[model samples]
Target: MAVQALKDYKFSPADAQEKFHGAQLLYVGWDEHLMFCAPFAYCLPPNTLFSDLCQKFMAHSFGYHPDWKSVDFSKVTWLKSGQPWQPDMSKTLAELGLKHKDVLRFQTPGLKGINGTCS
Candidate 1:
């Protein structure tokens, strides 16, 4: 469906990349983990390494979960902006082609939330 505007509605997006000082907005979600309810957003530099993202940021964000420690990054599947993506852990976000407002989702093959209830 197309948006029906009463007038020429045009303005800069409030969450545009320029709004963030040297950082880009990125969203990350853990598949089947309803415990988080939704993806977490972060304002980070494009040069942030993928390894740091998993070991630092992600660890800080989802470490409290019972399944967190069991998750193996090597076995985890990834999706970038809703499409399958194979990322190099040593590469930076920019090197992986991630851009502002990109959504990254990961699934731990055997670890679905507690009891597989998705939470």
Candidate 2:
């Protein structure tokens, strides 16, 4: 299965961004070279490979065991800390009309706080 996926995956940055046409994105943070595209429209992460996001998404989405070291995540756009997240988010969420209850769900991120973030 692993070999098959790797062989068939046409991992392209442009293809990914296009797949999520008009998706309302929430900037979680940066990973490797990719941004975490968590959309407010659904509790699940948007189908974007903004970093190594696609690998984890594949693991979660397919119920596969994520042996990160074995995965060749050389396709992400990595960034560093203390750097601005490009399109700025301070004025971003304020534009949405969503309520607190609307975004609440089991898979909602940050619920685990720092514990879930620590490597």
Candidate 3:
């Protein structure tokens, strides 16, 4: 799926300052059956990469997994509002319209495969 394009809104450093100070928080969890580890709270920074957050979540909560290396980043999905959340890893949290206490679910790359197909 394609990532959402930026809207016609204008952004300035002053606007960024307000958002930075009032940054939101998020809850991230693995999909069902991979729920052994507890979900963690994240301070949603304006410029945090989704992939970086995923790596941090896996390492901190579940320790090392052999299958991580073979996983495809593009196939990873973050869901909110029944849609993929920010499919582009390079996009920042602010760009994706993420909000306070937003709950997100991630489907691991290799676990579900793209469109449920075995890769």
Top model by lDDT, which number?
1
TM-score of each: 0.92, 0.19, 0.56
lDDT per residue (tens digit) for residues 27-96 in model 1:
9999999899899998899999999999999999999999999999989999987889999999999998
Each prediction's whole-model lDDT (CA): 0.93, 0.32, 0.60
Q: Extract clashing residue pairs from model 3.
A: none
Q: What does candidate 3's lDDT look like per residue over 1-63, in tens digits?
A: 555668755456553335646666777766642434555677657577766666665556544
Preferred candidate (lDDT higher): 2 or 3:
3
> What is the overall TM-score of model 2 with all chains considered together?
0.19
Give residue 96's error in model 1 in angstroms.
Answer: 1.0
Clash count in backbone of candidate 2: 7
Candidate 3 worst ten-residue window by lDDT: 110-119
Candidate 1 displacement at residue 69 in angstroms:
0.6
Residue-pair clash count for candidate 1: 0
